[model samples]
Target: MRIALIGRPNCGKSTLFNQVAGYKAETGNFHGTTVTYTESKVRVLGEVVDLVDLPGTYVLGGSNPAEKVSHDYLGDHPVDVIINVIDATFLAQSLELTLELLRLDKPVLLAMNMMDEVARLGIKLDGPALEKELGVRIVPVVASKGRGIKALFLEAKRAAEQGILQPRFDDFQDDPYSRHKAALQLSQRFAVQGQRTLSWRDRLDDIFLHPAYGYVALAGVLLLFFQAVYGVGQLIEPPLLALFDSLITNLNTYIDTGNLLGVLLNGVLQGVMAGFAIVLPYLFPFLLGLGFLEDVGYLPRIAFLMDSLMHRIGLHGKAIVPFILGYGCNVPAIMSTRTLEDSRERFIAAALSTLVPCAARLVVVFGLVAFYLGPLYAFGLYLLNLFIIALTGRILTRLLPENTPGMILEMPPYRIPTLRAVANKAWFRIREFIVEAWPTLIFGSAALGLLVFFDIAKYFNWMVRPITWLLDLPAEVGVPLIFGVLRKELSLIMLGQALGNNDYSAVLSNAQLFTFTVFVVFFVPCVATLVMLKRELGSRQMVWVTLITIIIAMGAGLAARIFGLLL
Candidate 1:
């Protein structure tokens, strides 16, 4: 049997999907989390069942990807049962979608999810009456907490067996008399309150969705997120270092060999180990925290907040999520801009995303600046990334023709996200990172290993001597820069190895580290990003971005060095 989960945005549908399907898929409180449908299988009630989690849509009729996908799925490949998940606290609004689904004549089951929130808000639902009126089983559930799922599953099986999954349609339009008559009839049977009460949530929505405070709250929240990433990321680093130390010692003892071969092995192991210990732990945990915030329904508020700014910059506010995700890695963020409706917007967003300093790059800035220039300089480098993105967006907006983007976004009230769903989303994204980035990381490490093993670093150091003279950086720094093109974070690790110590200040002055960070920040994105740029924007744009980035990075390096001379 095939069971389909459907709902409007942020109705706990994805969370419930994870719970029942026993798999990880992306679940964000943002509107476009599941742009594509995801399928998984699970056995319930002694029967094998396929479950599909469809994209969230406000209505069944729309041109947006999610809406079209949902409509297409229902019309062409109809499911045996339709689980219409709804936010219990906002029954009136969510029921609108449920009403549309009922028209499809499937075996519709109303899963009133987030029931705990409903009760917390002192709202009551007459489930039996609702079931009778809708002519289907209505199950109240707290899907995140695993409440009422067994009973819901049993009802779904019975509905499938009885073949009562036929859709019911009600059209109340134009004629007020007919509309009143239908509504009254349904009300009598359903026992629904004539109108929802004016509650604190309503007042809160008025404020949060307000034009001014909403955006202010958005900026404030974003600032907090960045600070948390920096602070919490630091707090977690020492433990990760200890773990890497243990792995390295154990591996060395087990692989007891001698001479140059052992050195090669150690180099590969060290590079791979550093990639996992330093980069992956920091990147994954930070992403998980961001994912949790997104799952809890905060990102759209950010979109809404940045809508004006995004519009001014020739893009939509919805582009911000992908841009922020770019801080983790530009490749996925660039790919994610596919969610944007406008091709022009996607291009601009993609271009800007690559410029944002991803965590891999951030690791470079933090390592160099904190060690040589102090914590303030390290933090400034981060702010500089945001500044550059904003400045670039503004310039790009002016360069392009004006296009007004539409916003038909719904802001779901915040709810405590299910741990299962959050974990699933984090793991899913992390898995994507591993698949897309790990190979590049391993290869970059191996390539650096080969260069070091074969003494190619000496040649590269000589080759970069002229550039180093201009930039006032030591020739040795070129070794890191060459490998940096392969992976940004690896440059820092390579710098540590080349310097023969974690403290780079002993080798290069503070000004040199500053120039290096600026150059690395503006330099070409990692190989993964370059490939994605080629894939998404074609070879022409990729080539142009590369040329422009190299010019800017070198120019910035020269200027920083020149300014230091003046000082």
Candidate 2:
């Protein structure tokens, strides 16, 4: 038997999927984490059953990729039952989505997830009445803690066996606003009895959603996030670098021998594995923190709060999703532009995503700028990217056809997302990065080794002299740029080895190093992103992204050089 788990984003659908599917497949707190549907098989009651986790969506009709996946599956795929997970804390808004599912004329069992928080808020759910009214089984569950999950699955499995569970009430039409109102009134009557108690969460929301303080808080949050990334990298990088050095020493002395062994150890293994040590330790921890914040449902609030500013740039608030994803890796972020509706919006979003200093870029920036200029310069680079993104977004908005839609987003109530869930999600994304970029990184190292072997690097360095001259960088920085086109992290790794120190002062001036780092920041994304851009937005847009980025990087580097001279 086949069963599908569906719900609006951040409604614990993926959490329940992890629970039932017995592994982390599609789980996150952010929008569009599960852009594609994931299918798995599980054993229940000694019988193996197929389970599919569909992407979360407010409605099946929405144009976003996640919504399309869910909508298409409902229309075509034959599912014995639907497990509609809803956030118990945000019942009014979540139930509106539930109403839409009810209208789909399929068997749905409502799993009122996060019930622990609901009960703590002193909210009483009339589960039997709600089930009777909806003509479906209502199973109150806390997906994170595994509370009431067994009952939910038991009911879900029974529903699957018995066929459809249709709703009793069919009074409301399918309009978003109408269903929103109806769901609200229904919740007001059944969920929140008497006066809804003033919980700490409500008070916190008031502070966070405040117009003046909220914006300040958001800025502070972003600033701290970048600073934390730098601070954490400092705490970890030295020891890890030393460890790799020791390992490389032992491997060269004892392990490496024959031509094949020598090539694999010194050229392929040492270079690529060294690259992973430099990048992943910093990238994974930072990404894990971001993933925690995402799973806690803060990213959508950021999108909502930034919507007005985003609209000025031809993007809805939802663009923040792709932008945050960009920090992890640009390839997925570029593909994620499908969440944005308009063609112009996707183009603008894709371009901005490329500018966002991804984790790999951050590794480069931290290693180069932080070592050369200071941590302050590294922090400034992040802010500089943000400023450029916002400014360029506005420019592209005005330059384009002006059909970008405003952001209509849902702000899920804050909850303590499970560590396992967050780790699983962070792992999935980081794993994708390792799998896709690591091979290219290894090949880049081998190619560089070959270049050095043939003494071609010297001539190639001379060939790119014009670019180095314009950017106020040494000819040697060009080597990293060559490897950088393949993988951004390699730029820093190459720079470290070339400089023969983590400090990087031997190869270039402080001003020149900072300029070069900024240039790398705005440089064209790695080949992975370029390929994805071609696939997502077509070859024309891909060419435009490449040309625009090169121009921007050069301009920024020149400006930085002039500013340094004045300083």
Candidate 3:
């Protein structure tokens, strides 16, 4: 049997799907978060069934990419049951979608989610009456808290097995506006407005969504968020780095350093150290904070705040999530572009979002700038990066003009994030690095080590020397720049190795450090990100994006070099 979860944007449908589907789909507090459907297999009531989580849509005939995908999937595929999830607080607004779902004549089960929020708002819902009136089964649920999930799935199983097609709304009009009117009527009949009072949601929204204060709050929240992640990474990185350094020392004591074999093994160890001791320490904490921001519904508010600024670049608020996600990692940032309706916007968003220094690149910025200069300098570098991105975006838009409409985003009420959901999400993203990228790091390091032993590594450095020479840095820095594309942090790790010292300040002047770090920040994305780009935007576009980034990096590096000399 095939069971599908369907609902309007921000109705907790994806949340409900996660309760059973094990975080298989991305859930956000905004509409169009899940632009594509995800399918997973599960056993329901002693029978195995296919459960599909679809992108949220208000009407089956909607024109947006997410809505069209949902509509097309449901129409083309065979679904045994449709689980229509609704936000209990907004029964009137939600029923518009629910009413439309009934017209499909499928075995429909209403999963009224966020019941806890409904009760807190002093709203009264006659679930039985609505269920009876619509001639369908309804299950009241608080999906975030895992309340009523088991019963909801069990009822869904029965509905599918029994082939209970929901009663059709023959009197309702064929167009979406008519169903919306009928939905409001149904909400009035079954949902009583029981002396509704302002809840914490209202109070928080007033502060969080305020024009001036909201921007201040956003800055404060993001600053604190990054500070905490950096603190965690700082606490953990040194000890691990020392341990790995000692191991390398021990390895050197047993093997002759002058030999080719020793070079290869040391290179392999450096790769291992780079991934575990350096990258993972910072990455995990950053992902957790990002997950918190996403799950707690702050991301859309950010999109809201940044909408006008985004409009300056030919895109709107919807494009900002990818930029925000880019901070965690570039792969997902590129993946998130599918939510945009225009192909032109997707390509533009994907290209520009890459300029947001990911945590991997953050490794370089923090190591070189924050540690050597100061956090203030690092912050300024970030501002400079954004400025460059804006400049690049304007250029891209002139090349590809946009006719798409502005963002139509929904604000999901903030909910306390469940630890399980947050951890699961962080791990889900981190696993991509550990499983796919980590081994590549290890091998790439060993390969570099092999090249050094055979005396071919210098030629590689010679090839990249033009960039470093142009920026007035040591020719040896060329090696790290070339290898940095494999895994971003490799640039830092290999920088220490190339200079024959781990202390960056002792080996390099301040201007060189600033210029080199700036170059890394804007350079071509790492191989993992490149693969993701190819998968998302096709091979030809991937090459196009890469070439564009190289041009941007070179221009930015020259500018930073000139500026650093003045500083």
Candidate 4:
């Protein structure tokens, strides 16, 4: 049997899905975390069942892409049971979607999640009365803590087995407003008020949502995050690189460097070394920190605080969500643009997001620029990238003028991030990068090594000599530039290999190094991001974005060269 989990955004549907499925699907206190559905199979009551976690939506008739995904999935697929999770504190508001689910005539076991919040608020809900009134089984649960989860699933299995149909009601209304009124009446009948007290969540929100101090807190938090990433990376990189170097040296003692087999082995070893030494060290800590912030509900607040600054670029503050996600990967960042209602905003966001330095690009910036020039230069590159993104956003906004809408974001109560959830999310994101990117890096490296071994690199370099001269880089840099389109990290990895060693100081001067970093930072995005841009913005817009980035990258590189000379 196939069961579907549906709920309004941040209503603990994903938390329930994680508990029931026994695998982490990314969960956040903000909307658009689950831009796509995820599926897992689990045994419930000795029966193997397929479970799907759908993207959150407020109503069946909503227009956003996430909503359309939920709506279309339900319409196209045959779901045996629907597990509609709702926030217990906001029963009436959640029931607006609940009522729409009932019209589908499917068996739905309403999981009233976040009951802990309800209890903390001193709200008393009569579960039996709600079940009876709604004509469905109501299981109160605190999904994050795993409270009442087994019982919830048991009831879900029973409902699925029994083929419970939608209850017949003479006064049932089909519209949102009518259903909202009906839900409120039901809540009043079943819910009782008790003495209220402010919890720690309420206390923290006071300072976190403060207009002035909140910005200070945000900056402090971001500072610590980057410091942790850089510090941890520094601690791990030397030992890891040394280990790989030792292994490669020992292996080379037995192999002849003049043969094809030796060439392939060297190429593979270099790629493996780059993946470990350059990418993993930094990527792991970054994702771990990002997952923690997202799970703890701080990311939305960042968006809220940045709304004022974002308006200057003609984007809603909500654009920050995708911008932050872009730091991890640009593909999903572009996909998350669906959360925005306006096509113009989405287009502008997409254009700027693709330019954000992803983990791969960061590997280049830190491993090449920072390792040689110092941390300050690497840090400057990040700031420069942001300035470019803002400038690009401003340009696009003017080119495609539209009225920007006010942001309406729900700030979820802060919760302590669980180590298990954070680890799972971090591993999931890291696994995606390793699985998709490493092979491309390895193949490109091996292919380039072969070209050099066969003495054909000079021809390739000659082909891109004009570009290298334009940027004032060496002819050897041309090979990496050509392959960088496949994967950004390949540029740095191939650069080391192309120059015959990782010691770049021997080949490129400080000015050349800075110029190269600037070019790679703003150049055309990786192939994966390009495909996503094409999908989201169509071929015409994708072409324009591609051209714009190329122009910007060349211009930036030339300007950096001139500045370096003046210095």
- Pairs that clash in candidate 3: none
Q: Could you give candidate 2's per-residue lDDT for residues 276-323 as a string of tens digits?
A: 567776787788788887777788888878888888777888988889
Best by lDDT: 4
The candidate with the higher lDDT, 2 or 3, is: 3
Residue-pair clashes, model 3: 0
Off by over 4 Å in 2: 22-33, 90-106, 165-194, 246-264, 458-463, 496-503, 564-567
lDDT of 1: 0.73
Alpha carbon lDDT at 132, candidate 3? 81
Clashes of 4: 0
Query: Which pairs clash in the backbone of model 1?
Result: 105-166, 105-167, 106-165, 107-165
In lDDT terms, how accurate is model 4? Answer: 0.86
The clash count for each model shown is: 4, 0, 0, 0
Alpha-carbon TM-score of each model against the true structure: 0.82, 0.88, 0.94, 0.96
Which prediction has the highest TM-score against the true structure? Answer: 4
Write the candidate numbers in order of decreasing TM-score. 4, 3, 2, 1
